[model samples]
Every structure is written in structure tokens, then in C-alpha cells.
Target: MVDKSARTPAETKDAGVLIVGLGRFGSSMALTLDRLGQDVLAVERSPGLVAHYSDRFPIVEADASNPEALEQLGAREFSVAVVGVGTSLEASVLITGNLVDMGTPQIWAKAISAEHGRILQRIGAHHVVFPEADAGNRVAHLVSGKLLDYIEVEDGFTIVKMRPPRETQGFTIEQTKVRERYGVTIIGVKSPGQEFVYAEPTTRISSNDLIVVSGHSELLERFAARP
Candidate 1:
């Protein structure tokens, strides 16, 4: 894992955010920022949404993917920029790259997936948003059967407590270092009458037991798919 450096200081004196793409995400985020008393400039290719939110937001009707349009909007003067284009990956890439090149104080982009997110990261996106995948997990967990628990965390990680596999039952915890392999840590566990205790490397998990785990977004899928 690359060592993340401390975040740069927020531009307290700079003007409010400049958002590209007036789709659902752009309008929604712009509205929120406007409500927060920040000056918000929204750019949109859609004339419909532009008219819809122009009165409520400071909007510039233009194709966000165009660097010339961004320059016309004076986006370089904003404290932050959000590229919220969905569907068009090429447009998203171009707009985000232009925003970074323009030296927008901060650039936030909505990514389609982990792989796509990596590409954006390489191109200078300050952060990747995965709202759908995250909300899906929380919604799916509500309909779960027998699974004790699950919770979502920042950057789309999950915490789960579920039963161990029958094949792995009776084996000492040390025999299988799940934490090392799965990139998740077992936080705690409960086995019927046994007292619920936080998990340790030496803690043996039995068959038909509940194991609390914390892991990355894909880690939860691995556990749920386990036979």
C-alpha cells in the first residue's frame, strides 16, 4: 500500500465549489453546498437540468468535458471541483484531468468501479465515490438470513459477523491466519454459551460460530460467497 501523505490545507478564503456535470450527482452536491452558504457554480451539458437548477445554483450551461468550457466558467477560481459525469468514462476522464490541470484546489470524481477508480487516481482525482455499491451492501444486508451483522465504513469497507465454514471447524485459529490472507481482521466472536470476546490470533473459531470481521469492499463478498 502506498503511504498516504497528510492532506493539504483547505482553502478557507477561496470561493465555493465548481461542479461539472449537472446530472443527479452534480445538482445534488451543488444544492448541498449552496445550502451550506458556499457559492456553487454548476456546469451541465443538459439544458433540461440546467434550467431546472439554474435558479437555485450558479450554473454555466456547457459540456463539462470541454476544457474550454471549464475555462469559460472560471472554474480555476473555485476552491474545489467535482466531476460527476456518469456513463461517459472518456468525458469523465477528460473533465477530471482538465480540472486538475487547471489547479482547482480539490478535485472529486465519481468512479464506476475499483479498476476505474485506480485509473482516476493515477490521473489526479482526489477521491473516488462508489455510492451505488456501498448502498447496495447496506440494503442487501437488511434482507440477509442468519448473518449476524454488517456495517459499511469509509472508502467502502465492511464489518461483518458470521459463522465460520464447517470444513474449517475445530481447527485452531493459528492454523488459518484469516487476517493475513483476507486483509481483514476478526474483531470479536461469540459461540453460543461462550462469552463474546474480541478476537485474537490465538482465538479458535468453531463450526456454527459467529466471527466478526472488518475488511475491504471485496472482502465482504468473499465471506458472503463462502460455502
Candidate 2:
């Protein structure tokens, strides 16, 4: 661990999301959350960066690894906090430890390596994200023509949008019995030249139609890959 002096200037405001670090990932997360009407408090070690983003949202110039600074900012009270110091593994780990010690309910951290991710989780970070790996997976999924869009709603289940394969065209929902046959649920459908409709027993599926389905990822992939 890198040793750094503690500094805690008085602060008066609280935020729904506490963002530590001002790197690309942190700044983007802070800005996007603020734009989405979330109360966001961003912390940065560099005064220059704090000044750079101050015009957009509330920013604090402080070292996230300093426990005093974190406490002064009421870090323990925030429901969610994200540690975005992947470039400096030491800093990331230190900040994650501080957040965990402060009892931040949910801590999401960015990690540059698998070992770094494991360390964050061991220190109680509720979630860890490898942005590069995640983006690569998304690109691979798209390139492989698996689906038009994919979003994992939870650990094992996902929601995906894709055009029906030629084999399933002209089949009614009841005839397909997707839920029973493929272990996936067709939640919604977009017919040719028409807006999307919720899936129903009588709804007819065509090759050109886009379907939105939700199920275990493996099952969904199997269903999508059928010849």
C-alpha cells in the first residue's frame, strides 16, 4: 500500500452516487449519472481535474485513499460508490478498502487485471468491471451475428433482440412454444412494417420480424443458433 497524508476539508453536501477517481471511466460514469438526474459527487486527486469538471457537477479535490477525506465527504452514507483507479492498482485497492471500511452499501470497482478484480472482491467490492474485456465481449457477440443487442439482466439470464431465423418464420407463438422448447421467453416482437407488440400465443413470427427474448444466456444462445 502506498502511504499518503490525510486531508479533510469541510463539506456540506451529499450525493446518491459517490464516484472516486477522475480517469476516463470515472469521469464518464460521473457525468452520465449526473445527466441522468442522479445526485453524484465526484472526487479526484488532481486539482486541475476537479476544476475541469466543476462546471458540470459537484467535484471534490481529494485523495480517495485518504480515510479522513472519505469520512468528511460522508462516504459511508452513500448507497453506491465506484472506485475508478484501475491505472494504479495500489490506489484502486486502497480506495476500495476505504469504501468497504466506511460501510458503503454497494461498491463497484474497475480493475485492470483478473488478480486486481479478485483483490477488489476480497475487500468487499460488490461488483467489479473490466471495461476492456466487457467491450470486447460485446463486439465479439455482434461480429458473430449472435444478436442485434444483448444485456445481461442478472448473473445467468439475459435479454436479447434478434431477427428470427429462416426456420422459425411463419410459426405462431403457440406452435413454437419457445418457453417449453427452448427454455426462453419471447417477451416482445416487432412485426414487419409495424411497431413492436408484446408476445402472445397467437402472434405470428416472420423472418423479418425482430424478437426480444429473455432467458438463461446459454439457452438463449442455443435457441438463436438453431439451423
Candidate 3:
């Protein structure tokens, strides 16, 4: 377990996730990350939004369009910043551009339009998300209610992180024949043993492990329901 309180200055510098503009996308992103044990700082122009999430998340009250606000929030130091300014396209673009200028790596922005997405790409955003599209998928899957997180990396391959059924806790990769069974391969296991998981075939599946498998989404679903 990472000792959050015992973190040194070096550690603190290494550990940072910044969120600019606390609308629905930003707020949910912050909440989800905080729930997943990551320290998140959300910066919003509105004082009301800042106050609402201040107790749960570290928040800064500042205008995202202003470069000075980025400085105030120590934006340059973040390892990955989420510029989730969904309300205004201009504000989202501005925040993303400023973060790029400041050399913050791995910025994920929630965009509304094709032109806005293109602008974000030109401004050096690492990832662009469409929240309405995501919400629709989330809602559709809620009825199905099996998938945990569906991350479309590239090509036709999608990374589905899901919970295994009760029976497969102590099984081996070879024993499970996961690849042949589901038409998808168990790429990795994110075990909560102080760090991340491995895709090694020999790695045993534990009950608490977060199985991060990659393949077609359809095949990934089969793996999610198996023993």
C-alpha cells in the first residue's frame, strides 16, 4: 500500500493528476479517480462547483481560460491532466492549449464536436473523450451490467477490465483456456499487491485481482461471464 502521508517532495512531483473545468465530465472523473485511490485536483471557474467537491477532491477555484490559473493550480507538474471542460468548446480548447504550452504530458479532454476534437489534437492533447457517447454506452451496458471499464486502445483491440465469476479465483491461465474459450486472451492481471499486473501465462488468477484482458469487445464479454 502506498503511504499517502509519508510521500516526499520527489514522490509528490511524480504523483499528480490535474482536472481543469469541473463540469459533469470533470466532476465524475475526479470522483472515480479518488474512489480508485488516486489523488485528484479539480480546477473550476465556478466557486459553487469548487465548494461542492472541495471536501472529497482537492479543488481550485479559478478561471480555466486564464493561464495564471494554471500556474496557481501547479498545472505544469502534473503527470497526466484531464482537461474536461465540456460546457464551452472555447474554454476546453484554451485550457488544453495552455497545458500543452506548459509541457504537461498526457492530457485527456472531453470534446463536443469534430472541429473541437481536431483543435484539441492540434494543441497536443494525448487523449480526446466524448462523454455523451460514453454515457450512452455506460447506460446501455448498465442494462447488461457486466462490463466494468471498456477502454478502446487501438486497432480492433479493446481492453476490458472486468470481474471474474466466483468459480475462477484460483485458476491458472492454461487451465482456464481463456483464449480458446472466449475467443479473447487474458493479456494481464492487475493484482493489488503493491503494484500493477502482468500478462504472463504462469501468473495465477486471484480473487481480488483486476483482470485486464485485451481483445474484441464481444469476446471480452464472454470472458467476463466465465468460470
Clashing pairs in 1: none
Could you give the C-alpha RMSD of every candidate to the true structure, in order shown?
A: 9.4, 4.5, 7.4
Q: Residue-wise lDDT of candidate 2 within 83-184, one digit each (tens)?
A: 988998888999999999878888999998899999999989999998877778666766787599887766878888988866668998888888898899
- Candidates in order, TM-scores: namely 0.60, 0.86, 0.65
Which candidate gets the maximum TM-score versus the true structure? 2
Clashes of each: 0, 0, 0
Task: Rank the models by TM-score, top first.
Answer: 2, 3, 1
Residue 64 miss distance in model 1 (angstroms):
2.1
| Residue ranges of candidate 3 with Cα displaced over 4 Å | 1-12, 138-151, 159-183, 186-214, 217-227
The Cα error of candidate 2 at residue 162, in Å, is 0.7
Q: Best candidate, lDDT-wise?
A: 2
lDDT of 3 by residue, 68-105 (tens): 76765567777899988876888888889888888887
**lDDT agreement with native, every candidate:** 0.73, 0.83, 0.75
Off by over 4 Å in 2: 1-15, 192-195
